[model samples]
Target: MLTHAERKRGIAWGLMSLFGITLFVGAPIIALLSWDMETAQTRLFTAYTWRILRFTLWQAALSTALSVAFAIPVALALARRPRFPGRLWIIRLMALPMGLPVLIGALGLIGIWGRQGIVNSLLLKLGLDQPVSIYGLSGILLAHVFFNLPLAARLLLAALERLPAEYWLLSASLGMKPLSVFRFIEWPAAWRVIPGVAGLIFMLCATSFTLVLVLGGGPAATTLEVAIYQSLRFDFDPPRAIALAFLQIAVTALILIVIASFPAPDDTGSTAGRITRRFDGRTFSALFWDALVILLATTFLILPLASIVTAGFKASLWGLVTSTAFLHAARTSFAIALAAGLLTILTSLAIVAAREAIADMKRPGRAARGFSVLLSGTSYLVLLVPPVVLGTGWFLMLRPLGDVTRFAPALVAVINTLMALPFVMRVLTPAIETHRKRAGRLSASLGISGLSRLWRIDLPVLAKPLLTAFSFAMALSLGDLGAVALFGSNELTTLPWLVYSRLSSYRTNDADGLALILGVICLGLAILGTAGQREASRG
Candidate 1:
């Protein structure tokens, strides 16, 4: 057990950390709530508000349905054809969409699907007069599917891969038909993942800010997030912004409630990667079907990414790379990203320390478990409140103090820190707990506690995990477009905002060049983050 003094101190720090995060997040919410209730009700009842709400729900539902539905077949194809050419490369490619900045992804899609894009170029050559439009709800769905489908497919593929060797062997021995094998063996694993995957995709699509903002065309295509941005940045409508923010929170909470009501699938035993080789789907028709699904999914995912690369190379970026404005934005993005990552590490450390202390106290399981849930939930609390909402709240809160743009960098850093908190905690907490478990008792017996122990013991030992957390957090913050959208100004801008400006000004080539640079940096950081984790595990 930790010493009484250390335990008490930890508990205090933990409570304080939780309270601080709560306050940071709650301040904006309080700003939203403290408005004139009568005015709030009036704003709440508007036709425009209801229209945006309906569109928001409709697009998110459609995106989630399309992504998850298409993922099943793609995943099944990959699982059944493990030895196919470029299989590993195809799996690796799926992660690209997740790492690429939202603005960059949108730009990439526009290059392929826009009115004057490659698709239209080909169609014109074929004597077609009509051009495809990458605007409105059609464009929004295209972007969402481009980003989410691969994610769902990867998740489902993992589930399929986890089935034990024995199950497949039994199926083969029984001479089960292909449909029977899928129904009894594969379907269960896929089904287990579907609900949780669907919920996550739903939440992601619902809160999507940059994608919809870029492709939303106008009011008719806007999601709640985009609507909030328009209210604060475009219309200067604080009351409407606040109303939309609460609407967003309510929608998110309701989704969570519905998701919680569905019991999660229980964990199945692991195969440890020694899967029983399957001897199925060898018929001509089966081969054709698998090939078709895999081919289509790969093409759908690759076209945009390839467009980003090829089109980016064709653009002349010497002027962009040498510009003062570009340099300033890059510097600001990196500085704010670094600050946010550092802050995330500190906050995660305090929270993890509290949890370890509570575990040492050996309280009743239910009580301890409840406290753990509360602490964990504190990290994720930011997710429910989209970054745009956070920006709007901060904007309202700071309006009385003169120019909000003057405080843009600080506010963006703070919001980015919160946005990165949940993810950083996921990475840092387990590593901290593991290290503490291995070293806590030994250090305690040696009378090592407090700052000395942290610097000498924890810091030295947990360096890899800490680096991983910092780099990953930085990667996320660096590419964030949502929080920056409402806060971006001439004095304070980020790479994402800069690219968005280019896109807005009809400077597609400059945007593509900037996107390539930004995407490479973000992807490199993501790779480093995961590489650090692997190295940490090895150590």
Candidate 2:
């Protein structure tokens, strides 16, 4: 029943899937194979390895707990005071950290909290002589919370928004106190979403690289990812690097498995046309407390960004802008981001196309369904293999062949593409599925297939999602430090690398200028990505 063009498309998609598996999965496996079991086993059991593993787990646990704990009260306050002035803008500002580059955010954080920074300056003026250091475990936690609290709040807020109107009405009619209402209504709804959200935040913290690298002041503060970087780049010990990578993979796999065991929060029931109003938190004392919580949270989120802007403008912007090194780094970053974005989109389309083709079959067999699922799940493989681990593996593979620096840019692009694949899949899959369901048969019935069907039918409908995916992929690539950290050199420096270099060399002014530029570029791309969705909705 399939047309010749359809068959060709399916075959092409299958080949693409094979290529992805070979490149992403097989390449790492081959690199790890270079390690002898005796050395790997010995390295794994060393005290140093255990310490790194423990620190990684401990920091991730603390970060997840704090982010979720702080987010709840903020989310509650926001949900109850929906009509407050600038509430929407506050929510939008919270989302900035999610898209902002890690290095830029770190710079912003240091500007406010570092020694001789804003906070320390204030303390010194007030006769508090001990300057605070934004380095070590405390700094790591602050940065993690900064980046993740907003995400948790937004997720919790959405969950709060989806609560049944009946529950709110009952609580209001009974004159329920805030505590009682939270216990009886809000807690139940929010609880379901918490596990998945916590798991997600936990994974993010566990795999953190740049934050730890920049804030971790000494050997005691290093993470497994940083240790992996140190081992490969500084120590030049392939056996130890492979051992650590294996350990990281094992830990990541375990976390993923545990996360998978939790039931996803159900948003199946309808709550449309529900007007939300809370009876609690209206008293003088309650209002003051809630308002105070909101204010503190807002200040925490905004002050660092404000400092970045203030300090950046104070710096010699023109000098930094005209610097050849800065311009070269910027150009290199753009080229890599563009290449990564395009490749990510292409790979995502291939995977999605294959899954759809199989699913749209007249009667797909169990094997076909399983294969489709596998294809759809391919992007998540990148998540399991952290970018640092992937980059290290590739470095080992290439070291024996040629000067690795010659291929650093290509490697960075490939790694970035892989990292962006999961996000691209999330954006593209639903759109692709909906379009196929609506138009696939129509095209086949008309004997229109392949490029003809694509150009006339898919392109018009998919333009928004495609562009959104590309923008996100590019933005992610632009801000990436994990893959580039191991490979970046004078010949292959990126904007983020340049910022780090400036910071490392005590060139605070230059770092500030570059951080400002990087943050603006990332924020712009994120806006572009969201704009496409807004346009599609308006149309």
Candidate 3:
């Protein structure tokens, strides 16, 4: 019953997903095949690789546990209060770390926790000779917690927020104790999200490159991703690099598989800023604890960003805006980010469209479930293969051709596209699914098919989500320092690279200024992406 164009669209989407598979999976395979077995073997048994492997698992575990443990209390505090000062902004604050650049967050954390940072400075003023060091496992853990805590908290809070209002009413009518209420109500909702959230955090921490590289001081604290980079760039050992990459690929793939087994928690239910009435906490002690939790969490999140603004403002303008290097890097960053954004959104839509087509071609139960799993799995494969692994694979494949730097833009854009796919899809899929469910039959019945259907129907209805997805993807691409680190050169410099470069050269003021500018641009895009929009009417 499908039109010719509809069938074609389905095929096109299927091809796109296949293309994703080839790019992510096939590229790495190509790299592995090209590996020098002698060199790889020599490095494989080294104590360093094993150390890195152990540390990678260790840091990731610690980060996931800490992020989830701290997040539960914060989520509960926010959920139970229902109405509190600055509640809306606090909710919005959780979204910042997701879109914020890792480099920027690192900068913020350093300004707060680094040797010269505010905390250590305060410690020194208190007459302590020992300084706080962020150059080891400690820094890696702190930064991971800073980034992942808000994400975990938001997931738990959303799950709590999505609970039926009647649950609270029943709890109230039954006069359930606080412990009983949480056991029967809030715990169940939050538990559903924890496994997937923890898995994701583990994957993120394991694949962490920029943060680990910047904060990791040296070999003593290296993770597998960082080890891979060190092997390639510092040691110039291709075999070691590929060996470490192989390990990283295995680790991330296993985590991604685990994450996929858990059903994705639904986030489509919006509370619309409406606070659900609660009767569990009216005691003075409860109020004090909630206040303390919210305050400490907010302060931890805000200070680094605040320092960026303050230090950036004090920076000499002559060194930043007027510099030709900074200007060129800014242009290059914007161009790459836009390209990555377009690709991420387009690829996501294609994957979802392919699934929709399959739905039309088959019956609704097990078949639909299979397609759902397939398409969802496809969207997440990118997360399985980290950017450095993907980029390194492409680098090896292209190195035989000509100068790899010539293809840097293309490679970096592709890597960013893959890296952002999971997030962008998470943002856009629900809207697309909602649109199709509400209007698909109607549009098909009206003979609205093909380009006409897309132009007249899909575009108008999905405008906001599409735009939001584009902005979010752009922000993430704009901020990423992953593949670019491997491929970056004098010819291709991004704002993140430039900032890192300045920081490396001891130009702290310049680094601060660039970080601020980059932070502002990212923050602007993130705000645009996360801004709430009313759903488009079927009319």
Pairs clashing within candidate 3: none
Superior candidate under lDDT, 2 versus 3? 2
Arranged by TM-score with the best first, the candidates are 2, 1, 3
Which regions in candidate 2 have their CA more than 4 angstroms from the true location?
A: 1-4, 265-270, 536-539
lDDT of each: 0.86, 0.86, 0.83
Clashing pairs in 1: none
For every model shown, what is its TM-score relative to the native structure?
A: 0.94, 0.96, 0.92
Residue lDDT tens for model 3, 1-539: 35667857775876777666666667666776677867887888888889899999999999999999999999999988878678989877877777789998898888889888999999999999647888898999999999999999888888998887778888999999888988999899999988988988888888888999899988888898878777766777788888888788788878877887986755555466544688877788888888899889989888987888888888976668879998999899999999999988878888878777766774657755676577777766667677777777777777889888999997888788887888788778888888988888898789888888889988987888888889988888888888798888899999999999888888888898899989988888866764646333432
lDDT (Cα, tens digit) per residue for candidate 2, span 1-539: 34756756875786676576557766866778775757877888999999999999999999999999999999888877768888888998998888888988998999889996889899999999746778999999999999999998888888888876777778888988888988988888789899998998999999999999999887799888999999987888877888889899999999999899875644333357767666667888877887898999999999999988988898888888889998999999999999999998888888876766676578878988887777766778877888888888888888888889998998899889988888788889888888887887787789887688789988998998898899999999999888899998999999999999999999998899888988888888888878967876799
For model 3 the local lDDT of residue 530 reads 49
RMSD of each candidate?
A: 2.4, 2.0, 3.0
**Model 2 lDDT vs. the true structure?**
0.86
Q: Indicate the worst ten consecutive residues by lDDT in candidate 1.
A: 262-271
Best candidate (score: TM-score):
2
Model 1, range 147-240, lDDT digits (tens) per residue?
Answer: 9998888888888878877777888889988899889888988988799888888889888899999999998899999998888788887788
